[model samples]
Target: MAYLFLFGAIVAEVIGAISTRFSEGFTRVLPTVVAVVGVVGAYFLLSRALRAGMGIGVAYAIWAALGVCAVALVGVLFLGESLTGVQAAGVALVIGGVACLELGGQH
Candidate 1:
């Protein structure tokens, strides 16, 4: 299904982002490879979702929003990063915007 492919793309994007952090400016070999591979897979899966009839506006909005949120969470939880109140609010806004996009598409 299109949604499934979108979900895969989201997950792959998250993995890519996390690996990018670990890649240390691409100085690290394994993480660098993983980052590149994950990102490539994400685009591939995203294309599949689009071919499966997901609108580009909706799919891209959801992918970008969720990927950003997931990367932020991973940074906080595993990478010892902090999320400021303002950043949290920004994340909420991003989610709200994605919800709006999905809702608007329904009409």
Candidate 2:
């Protein structure tokens, strides 16, 4: 399904982003390789989703929003990063905006 492909893309994108953090400016070999592979896979899956009839606006919005939120959470939980209250609110706003986009797309 298109949704499934989109989900895979989002997950791959998140993994790529997190691995980028571990790549240490690409000085680390394994993480850098993983980051590159994951990103490439993400694009591949995203294309599949689009080819499967997912609208680009909706798919890209969901992918970007969810990937950002997931990466932020991973950073806080596993990477010793801190999120401020304002940042948390911003995340909520992003989710809300995506929800609105999805709702608006259902003509």
Candidate 3:
């Protein structure tokens, strides 16, 4: 389904971004390889999702917003990165915007 494909794209992008942090500026071979592969797969799935009838604006917005949220969470939890109140508020706003976009567009 188109939704599934879009979800896959978001997941892949989040994973790729998280792996990139582990790649140590691409000095680490394995994580770097994973990041590259994950990025390629993310784009592939995103293209498929677009082909499956989702509007480009909605698909891209959803993918980018969710990917950012996921990556931020991963950074805080797995990578021990600090998240300040301002960043948390920004993330909440992105989530709210995504929800509003979906709700307003749904017929």
Candidate 4:
């Protein structure tokens, strides 16, 4: 269930990021609200995951990695953002780093 909570945090962060794009610099109402609420929820669940025995470094790395990847995809698919080769490589490197972090500390 620690993993579950981490997943929830990741999802909430992704949704919050996407909603932030739609928020138009906080000039909009609905998306802005979603962004704020979603982010708060993300932090809450992330704390729970940590309490459930997830290492802070590992959990934060995973949360940031997944949330960023998801947000980039959402931007490409829905927000018409550019995803160049450079961005792709950057994402790959981030995932690779996550792998290293996960594996390097394994007993």
Candidate 5:
């Protein structure tokens, strides 16, 4: 299903992004490779999902928004990155907008 693929893409992207913390600015070879491979695989799955019938604008919006949210949480928890209230609000807005686009596209 398109939704499944979209979720897969989100997961892969999140993994890749969080892995960057371990990659140590690309000085670590294995982690760097994992990040690159994970991200590429995510995109590949995303493209396949799009071809399966999802609209480009909707699919991309969902991917981008979800990726941002997931990556931000990982950064906050694992990487000790701080987010302001404004940044959190912005991410919530992005998620809401993505949901709206998906629902609208269904009709």
Candidate 6:
């Protein structure tokens, strides 16, 4: 299903983004490889999902917004990155907007 492909794309993007934290500005070897692979794989899956008939606007919005939220959480949880209250609220708004984009299609 297209949604499945889109989900893969989302997961890949999240991994890629988190790996960026590990990559050390691409100076490290292994983490950098993972980052490159994950990011490229994400785009590959996204393209496939689009070709399979997912609407461009809705799918892209969901992918990008959710990816941002996931990456931020990982940064705070595992990468010692600070997440201010305002930043948390911003992530919430991103998710809310994605939800609107998805649910708005029903009406």
- Please give the TM-score that candidate 4 achieves against the real structure: 0.96
23-100 in candidate 2: lDDT tens per residue? 999999999999999999999999999999999999999999999999999999998999999999999999999999
Clashing residue pairs, backbone N/CA/C < 3 A, model 6? none
- Once fitted onto the true fold, the runs of candidate 1 whose alpha carbons sit more than 4 angstroms away are none
Q: How close to the true structure is residue 27 of candidate 2, measured as C-alpha lDDT?
A: 100
Question: Which one wins on lDDT?
Answer: 1
Off by over 4 Å in 2: none
Mind giving the per-residue lDDT tens digits that candidate 5 earns over 1-107?
98899889989888888777799999999989989987998899899889888888998999999999989988898778999999999999999999899888774
Q: Which ten residues in a row have the lowest lDDT in candidate 3?
A: 13-22
Models 1 onward score TM values of 0.97, 0.97, 0.94, 0.96, 0.91, 0.92
Q: After superposition, which runs of candidate 3 have C-alpha atoms over 4 Å from their true positions? A: none
| Residue 60, candidate 1: C-alpha displacement in angstroms | 0.4
Candidate 4 on 1-107: residue-level lDDT in tens? 99999999999999898889889999999999999999999999999999999999999999999899888888899878999999999999999999999999899
Cα RMSD (Å) per model? 0.6, 0.7, 0.9, 0.8, 1.2, 1.2
Q: Tell me the lDDT of candidate 1.
A: 0.97
lDDT of 5 at 9: 91
Model 3 score (lDDT): 0.92
| Candidate 4 off by > 4 Å | none
lDDT of each: 0.97, 0.96, 0.92, 0.94, 0.89, 0.90
* Model 2 residue pairs with clashes: none
lDDT of 1 by residue, 1-107 (tens): 99999999999999998999889999999999999999999999999999999999999999999999999999999889999999999999999999999999996
Error of 6 at 83 (Å): 1.8
Pairwise TM-score winner, candidates 2 and 4:
2
